[model samples]
Target: MTLRLVIFDVDGTLVDSQADILASMEAAFAEIGRPAPARTEVLGVVGLSLPGAIARLAGDESDDRLARMVEAYKTSYARLRHQNGAASSPLYDGIRPLLEALHARDDLLLGIATGKSRRGLEALLDTLDLRRFFVTAQCADDHPSKPHPSMLLTCLAETGIDAGRAVMIGDTSFDIDMARAARIRSVGVTWGYHPAPHLSGADRVVEDTAALGRVLDDLLELAT
Candidate 1:
């Protein structure tokens, strides 16, 4: 009954930000006279840090040009934020219910560990009315990006929870990598940005919401 923390990723695992992400990315590419990658290709890089994702999207461009593209992306993203970011964004089906179910568990504490800015995450959470589910969060702006484990460590620090008892639920190798680096258990979601096979490092992978709920239940069982 002492499973005190559950940290989640944002882009793919919670809110499906693909529409705005792709639109804004395309706007970035257009400024550089390049084309946006298809949705499938973009999904492959969705979980990366913004700079990292920009690097991949820059392809063979020179450093200076890539930097320009990044600047363009930032400007475009900001403009897009208020106007279109949430227009097509939505919480994954069952996320609210799942959070509600978990929130009712007195021993569990919900939080977020994501490569998004704290303001950006807060905006999305407010849009979806999902902020109440979290008691703590660590966003990319708070620390170095995934695979560094600093964000997760920060979550542990701020929440005063143990890494050994926390479960990191996310959708990409970066997420799993973070969990493993932090020595915490990871649960991968198959429906998100990364394929299940690529999430091999996770303690387990769940196919859907029902399965995810079951996985959480089992983890709590072990914790108790």
Candidate 2:
């Protein structure tokens, strides 16, 4: 059996966090006495770091205001999670089963490469009881945000997995581009924030978890 690493993006890939994300964006902008960006605008930046996302939405804003918005967004997101518990961000359908099946494979290792901050990723993992499913988790705290290769490179370094033997699974172009930069294969999911058309660069684009599993099996050459 060959060892392979499977890296996942968190927000739109592993969990459906759109509601909390949009709500937090609204709260953050409200805290700064600014109107929130449109829902489509917010969702468009779903796979970037909070700072990057906010910067894109609030173009040309002062650095101080951007910092404040980031802090306010964090506060609002934490509060929402506390108030709603796991319900604030639930795993997508069929995801848990797929994760369990993958985690059980002796030749496979699971990891995370997300734009989420360390604190935010930890909270989600703990809430969903998903920490055990991954062997390594690389987040925004230590690396440049998505679309950069830092996170995936670090996952490869930590796991000693060859780039050829690893695959990145995500919903956004940021994820696909990151994997490409890292010289790894990518599997894009369409049921997340990004539409299917945006995932054209991916090695494979899956519509659901079942299709995702099959693509992974094919990409990683796993025995069926």
Candidate 3:
């Protein structure tokens, strides 16, 4: 099967932005007088939409209070993100080479499915000069979060590619689950936030960006 498209998840799979995210989230929680979860715990919430993630953090709170907490988080995050001397995030090593190799393939198309808002993704893309590589993007703004298959299906609809000809790549079970639910192939990555076993459902897992690129041919083959 000739793979028609590869949809990537932004934060963990493409760039290491967790430090900045964590810092901003922490400040947000602190300002609301709600303690933030530990960094390791926050990692689990990375791929979910804001409401979903906030629900996980707010636990048994009433919906109205949860809404307030979400607003507080937003207010705090808006103020702290990209401020306070936070370091800029960078792409994982070998990403450039990987993208270059894939871009050279005429049969392949690239897209992004992320929990990030469209504005957030555009900011990162513009900063990294990676906006040109993708032909489509399905962000958190448009639909329900991962494991729901909303974004993956949106990508398929946009690109006119069936699930059988697509592959989803990321570092979390959310990615694998979404692809599985959508009946597409999934590739998981190491050197990202998730634990290895979290990606057990992926068709294959790669340890680094170089290995990820090398395995794309095989992954695409299985998709077809």
Candidate 4:
């Protein structure tokens, strides 16, 4: 079989996490006696790693303040996750079916490349019952933030899939840019935090999970 890999972005792609993320960000800012960023500002930094994202939201805050904010954000998010239980950050519509269909295929390998930490990713996968579907998982804990290509490059290496035979599916410019930087094809979804214009750099832009499934099938067929 030709080795083909499909890498997914976690937050805005597979899961609708904006509410949890925004709530936690607000709590984090409150903890430090700082004003909370608006929803648009929070959404803008969704695809980057927590520290980097928090730093951007912090503006001119000192490095120590940024670090404290990051920690507070993590703590707030953890509390939210614990409180939400099974309903935490529900998967987007059609995501489960899409994963099931892809997992059923023999020729394609599945993986995740995200700004989420390994622990955080593991919890998400477990919560969504998605852990068994992925063969390789690369997280911010192991790589530089998105648009740097480290996570995607590591996924390609670990999965033994050449960049030419892989595609990254995501909802943000960071995801598309990361794929581009890694020399792989990228497919963008419109349902993510970023706007469609921001994702124009992607090789293909899709509207929803059903469209996403078709794009994935087409990419693999072309790869083969």
Candidate 5:
């Protein structure tokens, strides 16, 4: 049995965090005394690090304002999580089962590569009782934002998995591009924030968890 590492993106991939994300973005802009970007605009940057996402959304703002907005967003997100608990960012349908099934495979190792800060990711995994599913987790705090390949490369290194034996599964172009840069295969999921068309670069594009499972089996050569 060959060892394989499967890395996942968090927001919009494993979990449906659009509501909280948009709410936090709105709060961040409000705290900076600026109007929030449109809903589409906010969702468009879901896979980027907070600072990078905010910078893109508020490109004209100074670095100070961007930093302030980032802090505000973090505060607001924490508050929302406290208020709504796990419901604030529920796992997408079939994700838990898919993860469990994958985790059961002795030859496979699960990991995370997300734009979330380490603290944020930890809190989320704890709240959702999902920390045990992953062997190694990579976050925005330790690397450059997605599309840079830093996170994926780190995940590969930490797991001691070769790029050819690993696959990145995510919902955004950033995820696919990052995997490409890292010389790894990728699966783009359509049920998340990015439209399916945007995922054309991925080696495989899946419409649902069922399709994703099939694709993963094929990509990783897992026994059915």
Candidate 6:
């Protein structure tokens, strides 16, 4: 069997950063003297790149205003991280075990495809001491926002894994659609911002991280 590459989205999938993300978003809007987007609205765009997500949240704001909000978001998010120290977003239950189990498998390769900037992604991975698990990492800095296949294709390229042998695991439709566009499989996780119904585009939807390994086992079998 060819090595199966599993690409994961970072924010809602691996780390439960919803609270911090929401706080930063609200702070950004406040900085611009604009009412913050509703929580559900913000959550809906969790998988998009910062600029794309901000553009959506800004609605009719001018380009300059949107840019300012983006900068504010970055500043606020960084400050929040600094304040929280190591107590930021906690890794989802079973994530470490899942990664270790997968890493133990010679037939599998792990990678990350996230809307997070490279700096943010690296900081989170390093803080969690998880930087060694992934063989490839793709970020918003390297590709277009989610729902585009660029990130997945880039991960496949970097890992020398064909789309047929790859699977994307995330919590949003953007992740599933990206995999679909790339002609690969996707597994949706339910414990994130988006509910399972919203993740119907995924090839399979698992209820939690504990079920992820089983789902991947099934995907790997089908891929071969």
Report every candidate's CA lDDT.
0.82, 0.93, 0.82, 0.89, 0.93, 0.90
Q: Residue by residue across 1-224, what tens digits does model 1's lDDT show?
A: 35578889988898787777777788778887888888777788876677778787667778887787767766766676777655656778898889999988898899898887777777788877887899887887768878789988988888888887799999999999999999889999988888889899999999888899999878866652
Cα deviation of 207 in candidate 3 (Å)?
0.7
Each model's TM-score? 0.92, 0.97, 0.91, 0.97, 0.97, 0.97
On residues 156-184, what C-alpha lDDT tens digit does candidate 3 reach at each position?
99989989888899998998999999888
The candidate, 5 or 6, that scores higher on lDDT is 5
Clashes per candidate (backbone, < 3 Å)? 1, 0, 1, 0, 0, 0
- Cα RMSD (Å) per model? 1.9, 1.7, 2.2, 1.0, 1.7, 1.0
Clashes of 2: 0
Which is the winner by lDDT between candidate 3 and candidate 4? Answer: 4
Instruction: Indicate the worst ten consecutive residues by lDDT in candidate 6.
Output: 80-89
* Stretches of candidate 6 exceeding 4 Å from the true structure: none
TM-score of 4: 0.97
In candidate 4, position 111 carries an lDDT of 94
Candidate 2, residues 104-200, lDDT tens digits: the string is 9999999999888898889999999999999999998998888999999999999998999999999999999999999999999999998899999
Residue 32 lDDT, candidate 1, scale 0-100: 78
Model 6, position 58, has a per-residue lDDT of 87
Residue 41, candidate 5: alpha-carbon lDDT: 89
